[model samples]
Target: MSTAGPDCPQKWCTGGACDGARLDSLLTEEARWLWEQLAARADRSGEPSMTGGTAVITAPAASTQRAAVLGLLGSRPLAPGERRRIRLEELTLRLRQHGERLTPGAVAAHAAGRALGSTAAERARQIARTTGLRKLRARLAGALPKNARLRPSEEAWQELHRTGRVARVLQHPQPEQLLKTAAEVLRLLPPQGRVDRRLLAFKAAGDPHGLDAGTDLAGLVLAEAAAAGLTTSGMPPRTAWGALGVDLDRLGGGLLSLGVHPDGWLVPARFPLPLPPATLADVSWPAPPHEAPGCS
Candidate 1:
């Protein structure tokens, strides 16, 4: 991969950095496929479909700058067959090999030295800078559900098969509806709560980046349930197993629970024996924390 120089395509790139570009490309295809899978899974469960489109990546020094760009991403939702977002990074991490003016860690240290009011805010800045908007856009695009309903007229699919960048499939409108609803529900929660729930739900659905692409609509359902006061203490771990009619303790130890409240709060508990490394085989809570699809 060529470092950022005259040939690099990125706009914000400085000092001819190029290492992240290859990493960016390598991950793009897989990420796009994963988004489709997640969207499809959400659709099957009657949840919202993750939308795909171009993303704009940027990192600004102030929240106002970040907000301005985010507003743009919100406005210009990327449509299918479009490039991912424009990424922006605020950190000074060098991308390409430099003679030796600054070390990669040095930039990080410089950002760290500029102290901020809150650690969370600072951390958020760091994350945004490192991944930028491009990465997030790609992840969202890649993780969206594969729409089978939107398949081009047989002729269209054939015509574009060679030129199209994304897999052409028609998805039901229902998934999109569910995702919209979920996004609404997410807004009801505090930032922390929303973040934790999204992260957890993505994990529950087995997302690698811990970003929800609608793979586990259970999180959506759970968020709604919490908002409605259905599960105040956060959905119990057993709810997952109970749906399958399996006992936690009967399964044994290896799983734990991270419960999120509607207020953006989390309550973590060591499962089976309050210990780490607990699995389904080891869990056997008497009452079964929650209900599942087949708990009769």
Candidate 2:
């Protein structure tokens, strides 16, 4: 009997053609919806026009003054019947004060820069709103278990649900998943003690790299740890790790300066005798540890 493999299925042999077509269709639908929404919100007040009205210059007729007036006139298109009476000398003087040249190119560039800045500000606002909402949901969910008696009002719950529905349309993950992961991570820590960072990562996330430096999970863990007073800013990295029972190798400790000056000077400054109490306070004399001078 001839031993030969059966012919490959046509669907498998197509090599992602079907998947690509489906993805393209989805993207086109999303783009159509976005365009429709934008169009519905677009301003349709007036038709755009170049030089809506005539420019009357009131300054002394000079070559530079005429150039400045023409530059300003043609920098942007004027609206319908929008006549501008400009004193070319005053305009040029103000431009100089602002370190900008009184030229058409400079005016156009400034306008373009302002437009880009406005777009960037809008995008930043959108991102801030999304991030704030996500954090708010996470915080509320985290507190719900501890404050079982404290429940959200019906109106507030409905509003949150409506907002979450909109967020779902934007393809963001549900807040429940974030709360679940955070709860699991928090459970790894003892009520009155600390646990090894790496061990906790392995147990909670099943990945040694879950809490690695620069990771979002690491930032979240560290922030929660600090909030709970499990870690302190004064602790060096090694001490911080050791406090959590995490063993890190090839990690350097904080540096100390001893008997050395960057300017190569080692002489002690001589002060006049019989210093006043204010001067003593300035030098922090006899202050208790962790307490500032001039405080009881």
Candidate 3:
């Protein structure tokens, strides 16, 4: 009955699964057509990043989202000394920013133990005290010290996993690459009229292998909805958040501006854009003419 996902917990959930699964089913059908579009494009320009590379990642159930991502892509491990040096940088930052001087051994020993010490303590406190980007900066400052070591502190490791994943993300989409890719996806939009989530995929003329039709459609929806100032109060049945909350969280907010809704709808936030279309093509069923008049 819980509409909230494993990633977001129960924030917007109205205490039921609500429209999540239905939205997923609808999106899958659109993905079939999307793949065909990509194939045509691929036959021309060698298939850009949208449909290249494997977005499908496998990781243990216990792994955090970032860990699963890193585990799949693999990360360059840092030596303990290197980790310690990074920890010192974090301490230096704390001193500079907060005038809080935590000792090295205390931080290092706390590294392998429960994060009840000054660094995490300060972070938790700072996170609580601040708001918006200030809080984010505090959290980042708090996170740096944990990157000092390689092993899991749960708290420390989770933070580092995010930072590490971000570094990996930076390696791609270079500067404007992601924004451009998003633009390509957005260009599919009519620039004014609302495109049904289902029709947009087939007509969008993009089927990048890695980019699933569902997410692509969802991104456009967010862009339109943002411009329209559409809120959950006016949302139609079966929102995107229910179905793809966890997946979106892994992608984070900055790179993908999905709003609170899942990858189901709304429009534009920030850069970049995943799934193989063929895998779902077999069972896909599209509406015939007169049934869904908008799809061409």
Give per-model TM-scores.
0.16, 0.33, 0.20
In model 2, the clashing pairs are 51-78
**Mind giving the per-residue lDDT tens digits that candidate 1 earns over 1-296?**
32333323443222333223333321232233323332333323322211222223234344443333233234554344344443212111222223122222222212232211234455555445434422432333344345311111223223322432112111223434444433433332332211233334343444332323233344434432333333443447545323322223432344344542123324444322233333333434344458887877
Error of 1 at 287 (Å): 19
Q: Which window of 10 residues has the lowest lDDT sum in candidate 1?
A: 163-172
Local accuracy of candidate 3 as per-residue lDDT tens digits, 1-296: 21223222322111222222222221232223322332333223332212123222122233232232232133643222221112233322332221122222222212222211334444555445333322343343344333221111224323333434323323343413332343333444443433343333344434433234334334333332333333242353234322211122222223222233233444454523322322222333334437566756
Model 2 has how many clashing residue pairs? 1
Per-residue lDDT for 45 in model 1? 34
TM-score of 1: 0.16
Clashes of 1: 61
Over 1-296, each residue of candidate 2 has an lDDT whose tens digit, in order, gives 11111221231111221221212221232223222221222212111111122224233334443333343334553343344464434433433433322221122222222111234455566667666655664565455445232223333334434434324422435444443444565655554444555676788778866666765555444444444455765466555555544543322222233433224344344522343322332343223347677766
Model 2 error, position 82 (Å): 25
Which model is ahead, 1 or 3, in terms of TM-score? Answer: 3
Candidate 3 error regions (>4 Å)? 1-107, 110-179, 191-205, 208-220, 227-234, 237-296
Best by lDDT: 2
RMSD of 2: 21.5
